[model samples]
Target: MSSEHFDVVVVGAGLSGIGAGYHLQTLCPDRSYVILEGRAQLGGTWDLFRYPGIRSDSDMYTLGYSFKPWTQAKAIADGPAILDYVTQTARENGIDRHIRYRQHVKSAAWSTDEARWTVQAEGPDGPVSYTCSFLFMCSGYYNYAAGHTPEFAGAADFGGRIVHPQHWPSDLDYAGKRVVVIGSGATAVTLVPELAKSAAHVTMLQRSPTYVVSRPSEDRFANWLRAKLPAKAAYGITRWKNVLFSMFFFNLARRKPEKVKERLLAMVRVHLGPDYDVGTHFTPRYNPWDQRLCLVPDADLFDALKSGAAEVVTDRIAHFTPGGILLEGGRELAADVVVTATGLELQLLSDVAFEVDGVPVDLASTYNYKGMMYSGVPNLAHSFGYTNASWTLKADLTCFYVCRLLNTLQKRGLRQTTPRIGAEALKPQPFLDFTSGYVTRAMEKFPKQGHRWPWKLYQNYAQDLVTLKYGSVDIEMEFSNPVPTHAQKRATADA
Candidate 1:
């Protein structure tokens, strides 16, 4: 069988992939590319999640693409709205046509002799193959098929339905029924208020308190700017404004943890009133931004609690009883339904098997290069976002950097370029400095960062912007290994 070839092959047709397509179209229009998506739909996260009140934890101005303007009123938009935005982007830019749906990428092999990567995927019919000069992996950081669900003793004993938010049932009705939502992450916080709207009472059962902050769904400043200026102009200003503010707050949180923690708890008190036990249900042991802070739009979660529609329960589950979950201290929270909003299952390169010149490549053993490319990985890039800020911020920068690299390769007439590092040049560090359970559980499987520049992950968007956008690509990068014409011919014949 003959394999289709292109200048670039992008894995995953999610937010990152669509942005990459746009960048390639505008920046490198001469290059041909294709997007291979595992799922039937285009939007990855937005399309996959369909639980009640599903929305973005980050504001849309920053979560949205750098090239596109978020014209919606709500800065913290819902799932459908965000999906429409992503779909609209692809449709408008003609990126949708380039996407091959239901193509689950299985493996990729890089050939140094031919200066290309042969990608294999499990298509609907059977196995499919393609080759590309450059490979871009944008398939987010988590497993789409499953979430991190801990085993609960006697879970089978529960009479009512138990569902994980990752796979929420469509027809399962909970109207006027008691509901217990497990976990205090963004999903749990978002679900409680929305579930409380219909459920008789919603109980948020969390193992530990997570820092929660509330803001309006719509941004007044952003709205005012939109009214006064053009779409792109207003979006640019609002995006920067949010970026700078978040950086400042994150820096403050790190510098003065106690002060920031107290201030955050104080805000929770103002929302829950003086009688509420802020320390028990709201105060977190960790500093702010150590893990991501959960965001509630317009203090919805607090309002639900105050109105007696919902309540926060801080305890460990002893077991799942017939009526509901039984706590460790003999307290039983009776519920008709249970929703596990447990965290995600993290993965590297979407768990795709990679081989470099017939040798298996273990990503965890390699060092990260500017948080995009791995050390000694030739002509490949991965799009990973920030922990403290919006994901698209780093994604946008990564796309720009990849395009720049492709242009450089073409200009210099080079076939392959890899990040070259001396054996003792730098000390190894954790790729992400985050302490979240999802991150910690899968940290060992990820690539390591280094103590110095180009190998370090700053996580700060401003620093990344400077390095990826305007920084030199020649630093520690070996640009050689141009394939001979006859060598390419021989490789083609063998394939």
Candidate 2:
């Protein structure tokens, strides 16, 4: 296969990837880049997940790109709207023209001698190859092919249709039929209320509970600001306002877990009434923010629960019976359809194999540098978002920093930049502090973090903004393999 070379090769044409393209073009205009997308279209997560009630758990203000203003009225937008926003950003900025679809990246091998990466991918016709001075991995952190679904005992006995939210069948009609959604996370919460609209009765079954919060779909402050100020100015102010509030709330939750928990449960009690079992169904065993708190726009989930359209059942599953699921407490949830809103199957760097100078690199053994680049990895960075806040916040900061790093390298005439944890005896910590099943199950396979700055992941947007956008780039990073100019090469040859 022919190998085309570019200054940068961005993996995945998702929110992060498109943002990366925009930053590269604006900040480093001289650099050439291409976005390799595995799917036929863009909008990675938004396009792939077609499940009912698919909406963003985070508000749009902070979730939106820093460069773009989210003019939509809804702060908690549905999937299609978010997809439109992402694709629109690409099209308006001409980023979509650089995208190559149906390119599934398989492996990337970096050669120190060449000071570049050789990327191998499978295309529609055959294998394709590309060489890039920098490889930006915005492919996200989950497996695209499948979501995590535990092997249910006697699953074969279930005569009804059982579907995972990741792969929802479009033609399957659940109208007026009993639907059982398994799990209490964001997906289950979202699906329960939406499915309850037409389903006979929808039940959300969970072994434990998750912290859920309610907020209005529209932001009154944002609307008022937009009516007074310019769109960009209003958006910027609103974005910062939300960011500060998120930081304050997160800090408060961490410091005063009991107080936060009490308030959260109190809110739920108001929605469900005092007669409901708040302790068993609405309360989580862990502290708030321990796992991500689910967001229900306009209290839709609560309204469904209060109206008897949907119900939450907390119990372990015994097995899948012929008609529905059998609980451990001898409770059987009879249903015509079973939807597994089970957690995602997390993967590292889009499951792409990597090697440095022909030596295989295991990411699990490396240390994460600034939550973007891994230890000992050269000319490559991954866009990983925050677990506690909006993903695009961190992703935007990462893109900005990558552009800065690339520009710095160009000015210095350097070809390779690798983070080395040399002589630093630092203890390893879990990649993420989340206790969610999806994170815990796959944490061991990902890179670890250190105890110090640059190695430690703060997960704070403000701190990341200051560090990534303005901090020193020479810390723990080894810049080598200088590219000699023609004058230097001629002088050396004469000598």
Q: 1-495, model 2: which lDDT tens digit per residue? A: 779999999999999999999999999999999999999999999999999989999999999999999999999999999999999999999999999999999999998767889999999999999999999999999999999999999899998999999999999899999999999999999999999999999999999999999999999999999999999999999999999999999999999999999999999999889899999998899999999999999999999998999999999999999989999999999989999999899999888999998999999999999999999999999999999999999999999999989988989988899998867687999999999999999988999999997899998999988889999999999988756667767888999
Clash count, one per candidate: 0, 0
CA lDDT of each prediction against the hidden true structure: 0.94, 0.94
lDDT per residue (tens digit) for residues 117-199 in model 1: 99999999999999999999999999999999999999999999999998999998999999999999999999999999999
- How do all models score by TM-score? 0.98, 0.97
Please name the candidate that would achieve the greatest TM-score relative to the true structure.
1
Which residue segments of model 1 deviate by more than 4 Å?
484-495
Worst 10 residues of 1 by lDDT: 481-490
